[model samples]
Target: MQHDIAYDTAAGSQSITRAIGRVISPIAFLPADAAEFFTPVNTNKNWLSGEGKRLFDLAIALPLLIVLAPLLAAIALAVRLETKGPALFRQTRSGMCGRPFKIFKFRTMTVQEDGASVVQAREADPRVTRLGAFLRRYSLDELPQLLNVILGDMSLVGPRPHAMAHDDFYQSRISEYRHRFAAKPGMTGWAQVNGLRGPTPALEQMTSRVSHDVFYVRRASFSFDLKVLLSTPIEIIRPRNAV
Candidate 1:
């Protein structure tokens, strides 16, 4: 974990399509300073964090669950038949204010490691099943987390949750890491949509992801959440760092 904490502020440049998307989207993808892009701007004490965010979550997740019921059932069945384990995978993850909650996913791995110490999935890992690989690639494994959103243990948009072990490991080394807990964890966030998804074996990489998460925490709003939701499908089709 001994590495420079600095993240490249140069988000460089973006295309015309992305430029237009930046205006409507809350997360930045423009040629502007990425230092500004990742930095948290609003630290005002008066800003209400949970205001309208829950209503937004229910508004979107409820309909999505209804629409994808058949697909969810089919995926569950497929996962069960693919391996001997349960179709759904559950693990303890850090929620708002660092509280612990069991997060759900469609089991895409042959092994369910949920102990105090859990390893992250690497590319071409042998533990992945043929069906599991497809599920992870398209992010179908995350469909079950909509239940978490409904259950109010999570949000439709916020910092992506991490295992307790990961929280323990990085919180000490990274100064601003715990700031992510200011809001509930998310199904997708500013990090994932910007290709910051998946493993962070490198310290600087984790630092960048935390920066993005903190950015969301300071700027969480209906419009920002809407933009993150809109960008999710695009990220799924061309997944960046998902293993």
Candidate 2:
């Protein structure tokens, strides 16, 4: 099999094999001069690596899980009692380098309603249950994805993963869409914080969101991620464009 290497950094350039399997660090990519700016992380599957990312994800997610466990339980019970299906809904989402992983989220609709490219959820969609509507409004429905963050399928802050069907469409419509896979998908992302969540009927909306997603991929860092996470709760409380 052929592996694709997309390296962007001051380290000139070199190719490594999948079998070689070396872990590259942040210092290898960022130069001292541009460290203050949003230094693009090296994200080639080989040239840039996933070792640090996976470790960081686990470190953050485990503590969040332990802290949020009780709240998660209450939300799960609310979802179950308010809806007929399982409390958690799992779907195959595109992850780092386009790998697929089952993303977990609290069920927000009365029905499963997944298939080959379904419609994006809209405000007042009849599929949403009462509690589900509240959950969606406050972004409580997404709490279960902390599990995915812990499992390494996602990060606390990165490009937001789309439904596989949405991925197929956006990958074609937006050139930068595929570039989002350059990093691990996140539970929430740069786009979502800026009112990019909910139904996007226009291609330009997806285009804008994808552009931000790709931008985050090229400019992610520990402090940047922390800022995004810190703002998420406030954003959820007063979501500007939530469905």
Candidate 3:
């Protein structure tokens, strides 16, 4: 799945588009910073504009959002009744190229923690409200992220975005960790499909998840995305590693 491309660290003045094109070229030269972000090891041949996946995300997300409008309303109501805060939880997450974007989810915890001191959720964590727990277990809390897909901030299948604080910590600890950000974030991802969902309580768990993510980035294609999409429903129903 690997593509061979030349590397030149002196192309710092080129635009990101040019930089990406260079990476795909047989004789490529990229700036040092760009090289760090986009490498041949993680770049796929079918990774052009990704318009097909983007269109697919909108195609499914738009209708699903409309069809599930009522259900979403009900969930919001439940969250509101169960907690003193807003039903929707918005937190900053690192997007492609390490850009910051606010991610949306259903409010699952009693506290809205968006700071550097945010803690990972544990099984039967006291911070999780009863209704919130149900939402999280089924991953219904991620429904709101459909909006993010429509807005071009995410995709239906890719690597999931970590919280800003978590990203900062992991990028420093794992050299390949930040490589996952080359692709746009997703609601469900290769890691999730492979049972890497839920809290990464251990560093090894997070590292394993990153491995799957980098694999997706290298092998990403229209067909591969379809497989991930089709397999997702079965995973959801069976409820493997989800919290």
Candidate 4:
């Protein structure tokens, strides 16, 4: 019962026609009211919406990718060498307007579980490789998402994306959860920079995280994004709840 994503070890995009017959079709489980959050509540003039945001994303993302190309390649090689699986991991995540897109990361686990019941990695999950732990801790595993940014599937700053399975499970329980989908998911976000990283198994933890996410959705602007970018390095240095 895999939901939106069906991993092809040999990756290729099937037509929208083929996808229906092959992978279990994508579905929209988000509440209709949640769509309202997609528009910022503030009346302030903001360039980080519409075409302006996309341009901003490309401006930052392209240069970062060029500078970090060698390191990204080294990570990919190391991931493949460490595990008997593909170097990259991709899973369908709910994007802006609740559209599903495959989010990419350097594979950090021995298992490639992208199905309905994909499990979150624990603090010392056995699935994580030795190198994988270091990458997750330092957030190196997320570098591939620079490509996501370049491709317009993500942003340089916004709410963090979650597995679609988790989104389906939590959307009903946590009212503010799907509000995070108001904007494109990001490599680093308001919640992540605020020390909300790692697994959120508890109801309270998830709720608190959603609060930050909802705040970002309402208050997003050029300055706010810069603040998240500046604060991210410190969180990387002294990560709270990092696994």
Candidate 1 regions with alpha-carbon error over 4 angstroms: 1-48
Where does model 2 exceed 4 Å of error? Answer: 1-50
lDDT of all predictions: 0.78, 0.71, 0.78, 0.78
| Shift of residue 148 alpha carbon in model 2, Å | 0.6
Compared with the true structure, the alpha-carbon lDDT of candidate 2 equals 0.71
Clash pairs, candidate 4, are none
* Candidate 1 Cα RMSD (Å): 13.3
Badly placed stretches (over 4 Å) of model 4 are 1-48
- Kindly report the root-mean-square deviation of model 2 from the true structure over all alpha carbons: 8.6
Which of candidates 3 and 4 reaches a greater TM-score? 3
**lDDT per residue, candidate 2, 1-243, as tens digits?**
122323332223333322112222112232222222222344333212346656767787899889999999998888778757799988877776567778888888866645575677887899888888888888888888888887666788888888888877776666556566667778888998888888888899889988888677776776667778888888998977676
List candidate 3 segments past 4 Å from native.
Answer: 1-36, 41-49
Model 1, TM vs. native: 0.80
1 against 3, candidate with superior TM-score:
3
Cα lDDT for residue 21, model 3?
A: 40
Order of candidates by lDDT, top first?
A: 4, 1, 3, 2
RMSD of 4: 11.3
lDDT of 4 by residue, 1-243 (tens): 243345542244445424432322223454433344343443432544467777888999899899999999999998888779999999988876577889999999888887699899888899999999999999999999999999888899987888888887887787666557667788898889888889988989889988998888787788888899989999999978877
Cα lDDT tens digits, model 3, 1-243, are 123222333344356555554332112232213424455344553342356677888899999999999999999998998779999999988776656779999999989899787788988799998888888888899999999989887888888998888887787776677667667788888898888889988899999999898888788888888898898888787777666
RMSD of each: 13.3, 8.6, 7.1, 11.3
